[model samples]
Target: MSRHLLIETQGPWAGRECASFVRDAAALAGGGHRTQLLLLQEGVLGAVPGVLPELDGYLAADGDLLVDRYSVAQRGLKQEQLVAGSRLVDMDEIAGNVLDAAVKVVWH
Candidate 1:
């Protein structure tokens, strides 16, 4: 069975929390569980390429991750500004992914 992890990043606290989750999740991927990260609100800032430390490690894994378009727009991010592999998905997709995951980690 494939396991899924959902990370809900929504506020100031999420800046550090989401990054840690990405790092930890990437490390854990070798064990077989799939990880997905969702960034909403201020958390969208983390989606910006090159801003976070050791981002290459997380990107190398290519896990399923989504950033809220509404949130990104509110924060002044366009699709062109995103990290090379990041996707700007709709809210419905984000919510549904969260519901489908085995673990939902929320950083608020």
Candidate 2:
């Protein structure tokens, strides 16, 4: 059966861990699992344009890339400044919908 994977990232995207998460999310999506990469805290930096190329492949694999709305506002980033496929989602959506619907959730 296909599984829903939700990955919650909470640190700066410039780190090795963030890069690894992108690669892993791509792998999971390519393997036929539905993947969602949710950026929170400093992780919202990953949604910024030109910051990380690793996200391109993940997005190509049909990953649902999202940034926390609160995080974006906190960092003074506009919704339009995020990467092309990334969307701004509220915490309620993350906690009440995404997390509850995912077969597995990982924090990176």
Candidate 3:
């Protein structure tokens, strides 16, 4: 199966676009693709509950969630504050995903 990596650079305040992105990611996962939603920059804010409930739906759809370790720590977000099923990953891992030929990357 192909892998889809969706990078979210915007926070929840960025509006419907962010939610729509999560929805699209979920759809990809539900369709049997390997989908991953990466939260970077202010997008790390979405790791918290209620910040982006759509994230929960994405997880339910079998999509993986990744929060940039640097972004979360820089924003003072603790591991416990993140949504369940979300993983904190190094920037290098993110770069690897983007550079991988087998993975499709989408940044917004």
Clashes per candidate (backbone, < 3 Å): 0, 0, 0
When sorted by TM-score, best at the front, the candidate numbers are 3, 2, 1
TM-score of 2: 0.87
Per-residue CA lDDT of candidate 3, range 1-108, in tens?
A: 899999999978988899999999999999999999999999999889888998877999999999999999999889899998999999899999999999999999
Q: What's the lDDT for candidate 3? A: 0.93
Summing lDDT over every window of 10 consecutive residues in candidate 3, give the lowest-scoring window: 48-57
Candidate 1 lowest-lDDT run of ten? 6-15
What's the C-alpha lDDT at position 95 in model 2? 77
How well is each residue in 1-108 modelled by candidate 1, as lDDT tens digits? 365555555533435665666677676554556666666777777777766644467667766657789989987779888777777889787667657646555444
CA RMSD of each candidate after superposition: 2.7, 1.9, 0.7
Looking at model 3, residue 23 earns an lDDT score of 90
In order of appearance, the predictions have TM-scores of 0.77, 0.87, 0.97
Answer with 1 or 3, whichever has the higher TM-score. 3
**Scored by Cα lDDT, where does model 1 land?**
0.66
How high is the lDDT of residue 82 in model 2? 90
Q: Would you list the C-alpha lDDT of every candidate in the order shown?
A: 0.66, 0.79, 0.93
State candidate 1's TM-score: 0.77
Q: What order do candidates take by lDDT, descending?
A: 3, 2, 1
